[model samples]
Target: MGRALAGAVVAAAVAVATLTGCSLRIEEASCGGGEYPVLAVNSGGGDCVPDGEEPAQGWARYPEGKVPEKVGDEWDIYWSTHTLDENGEIIELPEGG
Candidate 1:
């Protein structure tokens, strides 16, 4: 029957491309007072202290709603004026650590 309907449409197009081609990769987490300025999403990577500096310990990934807390798995410290929000924009916090 038409090769079983073309093998069920190629197995439903490879299961919808593996569930929408997956997405969640944000590495680089290690701050000791050098090379700051980072912003990863998906749940990993952070360190963008841009408000006078002097706050770069480790962990930081805010870009989904200005996450103030609830970030574990990594995050020693990160200010950046509380992850920006008050006209400077760049808020949507919430990923992981």
Candidate 2:
């Protein structure tokens, strides 16, 4: 009886840990009010614009191959020190980036 109870407790603990770990991953940021998010070109900045509205000056859509859909995702991290030029080429940010 003691061994069975210990085994059950261990199983429960493992299940809880697995569930907690799954929930701990960072989720994508949300843009409410029907607005979508955009990142600035040549800088580590971002904004949320109304749906169907174009990005404001200095702000642009992320490139096709490097769009960041989740907060702290791979592309999100990459864009921290990189940006697109007027010609849409990726370039390293200048000093103080």
Candidate 3:
């Protein structure tokens, strides 16, 4: 019974971690013309920033459509609305911000 309880606790911890694992850290960003305008940023343990300024860092690239949008002038990334800032660093919003 003790072993089973421990296992359940561990499983719960894993589940919680997985639920909050996805995180987006926008270091630099910009939007413009093109079929798939790129938003330079470091996301999901990868660097998607444009320019060869820092190749040593692994940046991931995402289409403009996939990028999140900001809520008004605030730095909140509204994933639900599918809107995000086109330039500058990204800011994280609270649970309901």
Candidate 4:
């Protein structure tokens, strides 16, 4: 009994350590009928942001209609509808958008 318990404890510890190396957050959004697409929020990715003098809010659209992309499986894209409008125009609501 003692040996079995020790083995179980060691197995649990190893499992936890192996899983601790990565983050497992569940983002709240769906794109292309799947979880949120991976977006470079405020140029936070390790890669350098493109040359742009001003910051603008825009969603990262998929290249095509592919659903099982990296963004859906691995990363998540997040956005808020309240993003500022530049033109100050009354935009009509998009149907089922």
The C-alpha TM-scores of every prediction are 0.19, 0.65, 0.23, 0.22
Give the per-residue lDDT of model 1 (tens digit) for 1-97.
Answer: 9999999998888787789995444543443344444443323345456545553343344444434332332333443223443344444455543
Quick one: ranking by TM-score, best first?
2, 3, 4, 1
Candidate number of the best TM-score: 2
For model 4 the local lDDT of residue 47 reads 19
- As for candidate 1, its clashing pairs are 46-60, 63-92, 63-93, 64-92, 64-93, 65-92, 65-93, 66-92, 66-93
> What would the per-residue lDDT of candidate 2 be over residues 1-97, giving only the tens digit for each residue?
9999999998888789798884335576635658876777777677788989999889888777776766788887888888877777788988777
The 10 consecutive residues of candidate 4 with the worst lDDT sum are: 75-84
The number of clashing residue pairs in each candidate reads 9, 0, 11, 0
Instruction: Estimate candidate 3's alpha-carbon lDDT, on a 0 to 1 scale.
Output: 0.39
Write down the lDDT that model 1 would get.
Answer: 0.47
Error of 3 at 82 (Å): 40
Error of 4 at 89 (Å): 70
As for lDDT, the candidate ahead, 2 or 4, is 2
List candidate 2 stretches off by more than 4 Å.
1-15, 18-23
Instruction: Give one digit per residue, the lDDT tens place, for model 4 in 1-97.
Output: 9999999998887788678874445653343342334333322221112333222354232224432233334322212211112343223223322
Candidate 4 lDDT at 50 equals: 38
Between candidates 1 and 3, name the one with more favorable lDDT: 1
